[model samples]
Target: MKPLDPRLLRRARGARVFLAASVLIGVASGVLIVVQAVLLAHGITGVVLRGSGVSGVALGLALVVAGRALLVWAQEVVAQRAAAAVKSTLRRQVLEHSLKLGPVWLSGERSSALTTLLTKGLDDLDPYFARYLPQLVLASTVPAGVIGWMATGDLIAAGTVLVTLPLIPIFMALIGWATQARSRRRQHALAVLAHHFADVVGGLTTLKLFGRAKAQESAVRRVTDQHRAASMGSLRLAFLSSFALELLASISVALVAVGVGLRLVDGKLGLETALMVLILAPEAYLPLRQVGLQFHASADGVAASEEVFRVLETPLPMRGDRTDVPDLRVSPLQLYDVTVRYTGRDEPALDGFDLELRPGEVVALTGPSGAGKSTALAVLLGFVEPERGVVVAGGSAADEFDPIEWRRQFAWVPQRPGLRLGSIADNVRLGRPTASDDEVRLALLTAGAGELALDKPVGEQGQLLSGGQQRRVALARALLTNAPVLLLDEPTAGLDPDAEAAVISGLRATGRTVLMVAHRPALIAAADRTVSVGARELVNA
Candidate 1:
């Protein structure tokens, strides 16, 4: 996938202040560099020991150095703020966009890749923001400032430096183009490696049980080894390119040093003028070199972030009205000729399946694997859109409705329980951030999991809880939400008899519209209506 573009960041709404501050820092950094150079050339090299007293030069150098230090500090501080702002703005957009795209887009993409984009990929932008960005600004401002000053002191020196300046960017652009391709591949490899390793580690116990642990280990090793080789290949190219650019910069600066020395010996130039040429030439080239090096450093970030930008640019699969949509607590939901098809699949999962669900009704969709039970719910949740039809909720077409408002009426619990590393109370609060202690406890009790509250931490992904307990905790969150609609898929698949009975009772007492994909006999037996899906159609209740 193409990473998010940096150009989009330039258009971020809340970025004006940070952008302006970064610009100001760049200006200040440029001014300070010039002032410090002039102070060194005139204050110490020319007027200090030659004839003039220590008072003027001493005071000037001190002020100039102080200003330079402060400017550097200010530039760094502004860059950090800008980087953070950029990260948060982009990240929020990604998350919001993902909600709209849902499983339609995500089913084909790797979760590890998405996770990398939000975490490690975003973190990589910090250096670009803090170091390279200020330099990008200084690269423009400092060079022009030096050139203008050069026109006043020595046009020949200015002309020479300007002549070599274009060469740096040209070489940099060439390397950058090549590096861009490599960076993209390298990033892809890293994502693949991360996905493979995460899967292998999580399934190690299962692999051992199946007597395939050695094979799995070998597979992961091959993936990681390939990733390492790809990374080193990219690193080698970037290093060679940087080395070539640095050698060129060194040559340019050395030429200036020689010219200034000869000109001074011939007395064609004064001590201060020669010193200024010596200082300004390198300072001017330094920014250019800095730009080139910074570009090198930002290559990986550019490659990684380009994909993020693309995600932000992708139009959401389901678009909603900017305003709120009415709740359908009292009306029926209708699906008209809806065919749920995975993108790139020749055959649709649910072909022209038509159904209607009324208020206070609990419908269960049952069929063999891949019969589109879960896909149907995914479409209703506004996570995926149908390829051929519409989902009407309570007399309103879902396409034209506000997705966020419509989803606000739901208390969704997916088949798997995804709990973070937190307490039992923390798990339920995700459904409703404002839930009080008593409210959370009540919701847990309602789901038959109140005993878990205030006693232990729900380990990573709630590994501490049995499968049944995990499902109940997730159910508690759904209950706490108290939405008008409830959608679940294979919720009690692994639960014992007692736990399954508790869940079935809770489902019956929900007293609202419900749609679930069930395989459990208890759940199906308890459902108000059961709809069986066949080869390519749904058999109505």
Candidate 2:
């Protein structure tokens, strides 16, 4: 388990108020417990011993029972509210920060890990947040109170409690090291399971067609068995830790009990004082021990959350060089000698590349696979940065421009476009959320998107549509944006010849500056010019 990621717990101002209420719950619970203990010791020594009225005895018992019950219930309610605040705010923060990280961040990490952090890891935090949490403060403060009160009875008893308490934390810390390692390993195995399971399910159709799915049964079983083993290992460690802590606590309480009884027998302490020591001893260690146990659970969430924070913290390479793409006085884009190199690789993708795109000209970049075609497109879209050169537009540096505000000037449709779960209209509206219905229809027509499928459900990742239809939906989204520049990567690869022709025709008529990666000969011929990139030489296609 890892230390808590401070950012995960820091959230909306109101969450602090919820934390305050959780603290109040702990304080109230402690006081109520102390009162209930006194009432029991008093009631057991009863009205006969005190020579008191029956009404006084009955009323005292009623107040003790009702107050304890009410205080426990109130504490639970407040703890639950605090847990809700932590979960809700952390989730919101993850999503909002994710948008800033851009596609590069998503590309590197497993989607399943992100899903786990957002769902399962955060879910596991509930117990610590609600129950064992406030005691983090109470455990320290209440123990001192417990010892102080015990000193009044017999100073030696207070000394015993104080001296033994440090041993609990010492043992806990030593065990915590092994527990943290096991928890990290367990979390990693879980992430692998989630990622593999997602991949297997997503590609189930392919596996079935190849008749290799049956062979995969053993593989899946192995992964599942690994997950189970890791889970059991974590559980075993947790249970052992809990047992050990409880055993130590029981010993401490028993020692206190024996000491108090001896003092009482010797007449050095009264019956009430001896009983108080018996009652308060557990209350003191209970919070501290519970906190140590919960530390295991909270540590997993903290580890996962820190990973999320790491992704959200990476910076984008470069941005658009201008405030506005189409200014009255200057061109939208100006690509100076640009160079881009991937980390841990010596080969540069775009070595001294150059391009100057205007408002209405369509440019085509055609090349064999891995010949820097996609890298060029990535540079234009501000997804990757050139290592040694500057990209200037409208007399401004690309680094200074805001990618969020400037990326709005274009739309992108990858060859394998994916649709989110929603209606066709909902998917298209993502391009231009404020777009009118009529505008969506026009963009659909311009992108060769079918009119009939406009209102139909696309299903998850646009499974309901043919490959061509999915591409068109993405194109329709781009069209709706009315961006000055459009990027279409392998737009016609999986289409029938007619569908390919239609896709090309729609691109030619879009009347916006396009920088597309083309494989179709028709699209290449239709372009005003094409750049061919290969080892022999770079030339016009």
Candidate 3:
């Protein structure tokens, strides 16, 4: 990726404004640099050549110092805002894209990797935008301004600067190329380490039970050691590059200083001009030197964004955007020869599958494993597209309805609810954020979780809850939505007999259109119609 990727400014709204501000700040800093250099040089000349008291220019010097300090503070503030804006924008974009990709796409990816990318990967971009990017702008504007000013005073010193200034960038490019590969390697190693650590920690209990915890410890140690070594290698290269840039800047300033000294000795240059040229010479190289230092700090962030962009660029599957459709609550839905085949799989998940769901009817999809029960559910939820046929809702094609609006009609409860770390009420209120405590309590009672308190904490993925409690809480969340249609997958698979009977009874009493994948006899018995998927036909049971 380029140091300042144009795509970031184009996609992130606040970043464009931040860049413009950075350029303006750079110009102001440059002007101050020139003003301060000239004033300091004049004061020195007065004291050395005219034997004047320090009081003559002390106030002017103080004012200039104050102005420079103010500019530095403003620049820092703007840089921090820019970094925050860019990170927030990118994080949002990545998450939205992931959601759009649907559950099928996510199934192939590791949860830990996705989590790390969204959190730590995006966070590392802070230094790049906050520090390196501002220096990049300053590197361009400040040196040019300093050189232009020096030219008016002494052409020879200015000409010397012009000659040696190019060498700093030349060396920068060469060293940057050498360090880039190493930086990328280090970033990859760090990502691997993070992914492995998250995976191990997430399943630590399972590892302990299986007596593989000791073996996993050795694996973790190996990856950690590899990351450490890679980090050291990257730092060594970064230090060398910094050294090269600093050495080049120092040499350039020395050449300019030598030219000014010789001119002053020959009486062609005044003391003030010689002193000003010397003072401004190092300032000309300062921005570029700083850019080199900051570039290394932001390398990991840049590498992480490369993956972000890749995901963002992936094509989304076609879905209808039209919002006009009859009320799904009373609408009859029918699948006409729907077929779905996932990538990298030889057999079709759903082939020529057909089914109809009527309002207020409970339909159960029962089939062997991999017989397209879940795939059919995905089709109804607008998460998967069928290649061969169409789904009709209310005598109109499903494709004619807006995907987002269509999804709003259904309350879905998956086999695993994918609960976050929060209170039980928090999970229930997720689908209906503004739902009152009374409404939540009623929904919990309806879903047979009246015993669980709303304020009770559910640890990550509802670790604090038993299987029955987790399912009931998920059902409560679904009930909170009060959508016209209910789609559930294995809603009673893991529950005890009593809990399972209660769930089936609650589902039957809802009087809403219910579509579920179920293997349990009790759940199938509650359904108005049971359809088999494995026989390439719906066998009514």
In candidate 3, position 288 carries an lDDT of: 88
Model 3, residue pairs in steric clash: none
- Which pairs of residues clash in candidate 1, taking residues 3 or more apart in a chain or in different chains? 2-306, 2-307, 3-306, 3-307, 4-305, 4-306, 4-307, 4-308, 4-309
- List the candidate 1 regions with Cα displacement exceeding 4 Å: 1-8, 11-19, 28-55, 103-107, 211-217, 254-272, 322-327, 421-457, 496-502, 520-522, 525-528, 534-541
Model 1, 320-343: lDDT tens digits are 684446566877788888887776
Alpha-carbon deviation at 20 in model 2, angstroms: 2.2
TM-score of 2: 0.89
Measured with C-alpha atoms, the lDDT of residue 434 in candidate 2 is 98
Against the true structure, whose TM-score is highest?
2
lDDT of 2 by residue, 280-362 (tens): 78887887788777776666665565665665566656454545544412366766677878777798877777666666766
State TM-scores per candidate.
0.85, 0.89, 0.88
Give the lDDT ranking, best first. Answer: 3, 1, 2
Worst 10 residues of 3 by lDDT: 532-541
| Residue 363 of model 3, lDDT score | 91
- Candidate 1 local accuracy as lDDT? 0.78
> Positional deviation of 44 in candidate 2, in angstroms?
4.8
Per-model C-alpha lDDT, please?
A: 0.78, 0.74, 0.85
Q: What's model 2's lDDT at 49?
A: 69
